[model samples]
Target: MNQGQAAAVFEGVYARRLDMIHRFPPGLRALGTRYIEPLFVAIGPYHRHLPRVQEMERMKRVAVHQFMQDTGLDWDALLAAAGVVAAQARALYDIPPAQNQGGDDPAAVQVPEAADQGEPQPHEQGAGQQEQNQDGVGPAAEQALGAGVQEVLAAGHHGIPLPPLPMSNAGFQEMLCIDAFFLLHYISMRDADNVPPSALAHLFYSRRSLIDNDIMLLENQIPFFVLTHLNELHPIFLRPFVAKLATNFHGHKSTRRIPPFQHHGYTPPHLLALLRFCMKEPVPAPPAPDAAGGPQQAPDAGGGPQQAPDVEDGAQAPAPDAGGGAPPALDAAGGPQQAPDVSITFTAIGLEEIGINLNVSDRNRFTDMAIRKRSFGPHLFKDPLLLGRELVLPQLFLGNVSSNYLVNMAAWEVCTAESYVERDTIVCSYIRILAMLMHREDDVHQLRAVHLMEGELTDRETLDLITSLGKHLPMGERYVRMLASIEEYKLVTWFWIAVHKLFYLYFKKIATFFAAIGSLAGVFKAFELVLVKKHQ
Candidate 1:
């Protein structure tokens, strides 16, 4: 270990791309490990040793046999190509926090379930990884929960090799091949009209819900590069598989066709990321101000019950100036990166009271939210409004099946946010937006009534999940801007709102007075009837 070697390590670690998959940060584990940990199966090296998922390990071998049999691809050729990819990807996983230092130091942060199960919970470096660490394409320096490799790199030290990987290269390559084939087979058979052949029928049918949940966990992911490399070597099944995952587990009976996200040039980091990319449409540019000096209230050209302005799926728009206080920002991996809370000032009922109606977008995307000032023209709600604004948003389904996935997607944004990233921290922002507009069970009821949300979850559960999830997330740019716009809308339209509130209160009081009179009349009639009976 010399100065030159140390500097080279620093450069390699510093210049590398961030980890493709990571343990959900410690702050988020309080939400429950079930939200982030895989419940059914492990897809990569991180969770392979867990006793709970070990049953599925045998299933992977079955997958290899089935995949080779079904596709008629040569096993030796697939192995050679995938093995090369495994070498390139060995450095992609995050080094466990306890990699270098054994967890004997009572202070190390332990992953709750992993620690108790005796699974390698990020403690003590394995010797194998260090020997494999030669200069170029070496394992990356990662930010483990408390112990950051970046910190040591920052301080400048003699070259010390990183801790060994969780598994050796030969073992890693085999794991990738098995895992990839397992997924390919799973996708090919999971939604077939006919019963899945053999063991797959039981594996995918009986545990369908749990397996779907596991697939979306951030920690339980393999690098997307492995899938792409395999795709290059003939069996190009990644496209429809990604589309199905993104479309919320739609039936993937045919993988040979359907080009939903394939043409978009999206290189997702993992399956969960692919889902996010599919759910996201780039934020649209703000409407330009008119000669009247307000955001132009353009008429709906596309006649619809609800429509988010059509834009190219790949169109990237910068965040509009919020026009208020400093909005919170998410930072890259490592260090303190939480933004201050920006609460939505209005609830669903409150918005309705102020004449701001919520509408669902035709395309269900997390990034879809728009505020259009009411103008005298043709509209999606069918009637042109002379006053009030239409707040358009995408429909969201909240239930046990989607809850964990939604939370992890938000956590992913927080964990992987980079300095030079886009303004949309979508899932978190969307959750916060929901939280901002919902205050109680009645608010959730309002959402359902308007078709903004639909799921098996009770109103209380939906309320609890989004509100709690919102508190944990760093406020996203999209959420911040929307909050600001609504706040500004309130300020400019205060006169109209005050007038509406006054009339609403007056009408409500009048209705209450009439209801009281009707009650008194009923009581008098009952007394008269009792007197007549006594006289008889």
Candidate 2:
């Protein structure tokens, strides 16, 4: 191609948004590919030719046939609809076109398909056949496996123009439509009792966990638009059924409490995107500035006095002056005020000792939390003291798959949508805060005690999961400020408790000494009275 043609192609590729799905970065993949790559099946072009995942092609063919027959949809009609949006769907994937040609690769072993009941196809020869020939298997063994393979392949050819096995552009479009249809049908009928039996039904039932894991992978996704278009072309009754299936499969129950669709204003791009969206909390607008251009102070928990305009939750607060002079001056540019001490000296455990109850709230929406005073107690010389300071945290669920899923989502946000990092720092900030809180196994245990974490993993495992997932995440300026504030609050609380204990000890010692002195004086007075009576 000439330079002009090359430039035009480059422009065409770059100008469009093809970043919906991405392969894990080198650092993340270095940890392990098991979590990022599909293990049981390949749903999209990225993993279509992987040798290990080729066996699933047969199953996809079965699903396509069963789905078409049950729904009574014409095969050609599905292909025609998919063809209309083939280019649009293709643009959403990041894989190269050349990778879609499956038969050329020596490592990719295609499953053998026989044309007749008793005879194998003359052209078919691959790993399964080679094994059969070498083993000299009996006629019964050959008939059973061979008949199954033939049935699968026959269904592929008759049901969908594009089978899961790789082919030309036309075949690719058909693959998109068939794969999407399979997913929709499977999820929609997963709970139904009257579903017809097929190869897919058996695979899905026997290896449900494996299939679910693979489908959730970021790379193993078809464009949502393809699924939407196909659903639209189908019967009206099926559209809502498929949509509800998608929502139930991807949406978290905690997030469903507050519907994201109402707030996000746009539909999620795909299944993975839908799951990510459900987990996302609406980013609160930045707090407005006061007349002096500093953050407005919130009333103290006691509600008797307003504290120095409490800084925004994520912004840095000016360090309190040691000399008790005017509050440290706000920065001229309204940026974060410089603090004398930014180091974190305590953990959640320390905060707990200061009469702060660290209870897990039902709202596990990471961003949802508040610091509040639960009660006030009378003081000798001051206004009622804020007695119970509570840190209400959303319940965090950690499990075997939690780290993998969360890290991938965060990576997607960081790599594809840079603007989201600035606007919605909740995911990054939450991870960082967790990392900070769980610096040791004890921290995890403490959180578990408070029911903040519900997981079967050991304390060490929990810490490792958080640390590994949170590595390399950018700590936003707001997040830094928030940490600084928490650290400062911890230090102040620790000091007050220490001072109170010291005064209590001192007063107790003084009272004991006075009591001893008073007893001695009474004894001396009694002895003097006895001497006076003897003299009389």
Best by lDDT: 1
Measured with C-alpha atoms, the lDDT of residue 79 in candidate 2 is 67
| C-alpha lDDT (0 to 100) for residue 338 of candidate 2 | 48
Q: Score candidate 2 by lDDT.
A: 0.54
Q: Write the per-residue lDDT of candidate 1 for residues 157-250, one digit (tens) a residue.
A: 3323223233445556666777776665676565444355576668777887787788788777877877766754434344444555554422
Candidate 2: tens digits of C-alpha lDDT, residues 1-536: 99999999877654543335565555555445666667788787655644456557656655665666566665667667778888877766653333334433222222212222322122243433333222222233334344433443454335321123323454467568667876766664554443556655677878766776677677678877677677664422222222232332222442221111212233445666555544543333334555743234332221111324432322333333222233334476644464667654446776655545566655445545545554443332221355435566666666545555566666555545433222345566667666767778989988888787766568988888777766766664334555454555556666665654454546678778899899999999999999999999
Q: Candidate 2 regions off by >4 Å? A: 1-19, 99-168, 192-199, 235-264, 281-341, 344-346, 353-357, 371-384, 387-389, 419-423, 476-478, 487-536
Count of steric clashes across candidates, in order: 6, 1
How far off is residue 256 in model 2, in Å?
14
